[model samples]
Target: MTRSLGFGVLLALQFLTRLPVPVQCPWNADTSRWAVRCYPLVGLLLGGILALTGRLLEGWLPTPMLALLLLSLWVALTGGLHLDGLMDVADALGSNASLERRWAIMKDPHVGSFGIIALVFLLVWKGTLLLALLESGVSLAVLVAVLALGRFGAVALLVLSPAARPEGMAWAWKQHLGHRDLLLALWPLPLCFWLLPGGMVLFAALVPFLLLYGLAMIRAFKGINGDIVGAAIEGGELWLLLVAWIWWSSAMG
Candidate 1:
C-alpha cells in the first residue's frame, strides 16, 4: 500500500512539476487515474519550495527583485506548463473565430498576440502581488495556503466537470476521479486552515469564484480539458492571492 502511494506521489510530481521522481511502475489508466488524487500533495510540495525561497531570500535583495526572482523560480519549477495553457486559452478566446477554429488555435504550437499579452499581464500581476504581500508583512504560511488552494481548485474542476475532449490527459485524469478522489484531494484543507490567519474566510471567498470560472469554461469551450484545468490552476492562484492580499492588508492596517 505504501509503495503504491509512493508511486502515485511520483506520478503526481512528474505530471504537475518538473521535479525529478524516478518511477519504473507500469503505466496504465489505473495508475494515471490515481495521480489525480495526489494533486494536492504536489501543490504542498510546490508551496513548501515557494515559502522556503521567499524566506531564505527575504532581506538579501530588494523586494521587487526578490518577487521577480520568486516568480521566475515558480515558473521554472513548473516548466511554465500552466502558463502555456493560460496563454492558449487566451489566444483561443481573443480570436474572433469559430469554436472549431478556437480549438485548433489552442492546439497550435505557436502562440498568438493575445497569448503574449495575457502572459505579460499575468507575470506582471503575480510579481506585483507578491511584492505587496511581502511589503505588508504577510507570513510565508499564507503563500503556502495560496499554492495548495490553487491546486485544490484544479482537483475540484476535475471531479465536477466533464472533459471536452474524448482523448487526452484531462479525460484520463477524469476517469478515476470520483467522490472518493475528491475527499482525498481535500487533505490539504486542514493544513491550510492551520497555515493562514483567516483561512476559512479566504476559502469561502475562493470557492464561488472558482466555481464561476469553471462554469464559464464549460460555456466557452463546451467542456473542460487539460488546458482548462491548467488555466484553472493559474487562475485560482491569482484569485486566492487577491483574497489573501486583501485579508492581510485589512488585518495589518
Candidate 2:
C-alpha cells in the first residue's frame, strides 16, 4: 500500500507539474486512483517550494518585484498548464456561441483575443494580490494553505461533477475516481486549516466558493472537462489568495 501510494504521488507530480520524477509509474486503475487522491499532496509540495522561495527572497527584493518573481515561478512550476485551460475557457465563453461551437473553440490550438485579454487580467490581478499580501507581512503558511485548498477543490470538482464529454483525459481519469477517493483527498483540508490563521472561517468561506464555482462551470461548459478542471485550479487559487489577503489586511488594520 505504501509503495502504491508513493507511485501515486509520483504520477500526480508528473502530471500536475513540470518536475522530473525520474521513475516511471505503471499506469493502471490503482495508480490512477492514487493519483487523484494525491492531487492535494502534490499541491502542498508546490506550496512548500513557493513558500520557501518567498521567504528567501523577502529581504532582498521589493514587494512588486518579489510578487512578480513568485508569480513567474508559479507559472514555471506548472508549465502554465492551468493557464492554458483558463485561456481556452475564456475564449470559448467569449465566443458566446452554441455549446458545441464553444467546445470546438476550446479545442482549437490557437488562442483568441478573449484568451489573451483574460490571461493579462488574471496575471495582473494575481500579481496585485500577491503584492498586497507581501506588503502586509502575511504569513507564508497562508500561501501554502491557499495552494493546497485550491487543488483540493479541483479534486473535489473532478469526482463530484459530470464530465463535459464522454471521452478525453478528464473522463478517463474519472473512471478511476469515486467519492472514496475524494474522502482520501480530505487529508489536506485539516492541514490547510492548521496552516492558516482563522483557518476555520477561511475554510468555511472556501466551501461555498467551490460549490458556486463548480456549479457555474457546469452551467457554462455543460459539464466538467480537462479545461474546466484546469480553470477551477487557477480560479480557485486566485480566489483563495484574494480572500487571504483581505483577511490579513483587515486583521492587521
Q: Please report the candidate that would top lDDT against the real structure.
A: 2
Candidate lDDT (C-alpha), each: 0.84, 0.87
Candidate 2: pairs in clash: none
- Which ten residues in a row are the worst by lDDT in model 2? 196-205
In order of appearance, the predictions have TM-scores of 0.96, 0.96
lDDT of candidate 1 over 1-253, digit per residue (tens): 5666667778888889998776676456556656777787788779889899899999999998988888999999899999999999999999978889989999999999999998999888888899999999998777778778788888889888889888888887887678788888788678878877688876787789887998888888888889889988988888788888888899889
Misplaced by over 4 Å in model 2 are: none
The regions of model 1 sitting more than 4 angstroms off are none
* Superposition error at 39 for model 1 (Å): 0.9
Q: Write the per-residue lDDT of candidate 2 for residues 1-253, one digit (tens) a residue.
A: 8888888899999999999889989888888889889898888888888989999989899889999999999999999999999999999999999999999999999999999998999999999999999999888777778777778888888899999889888898999898999999978667766777576655666788889988888898878999888888898888888888888899999
**Over the full model, what C-alpha lDDT does candidate 2 score relative to the true structure?**
0.87
| Residue 109 of model 2, lDDT score | 98
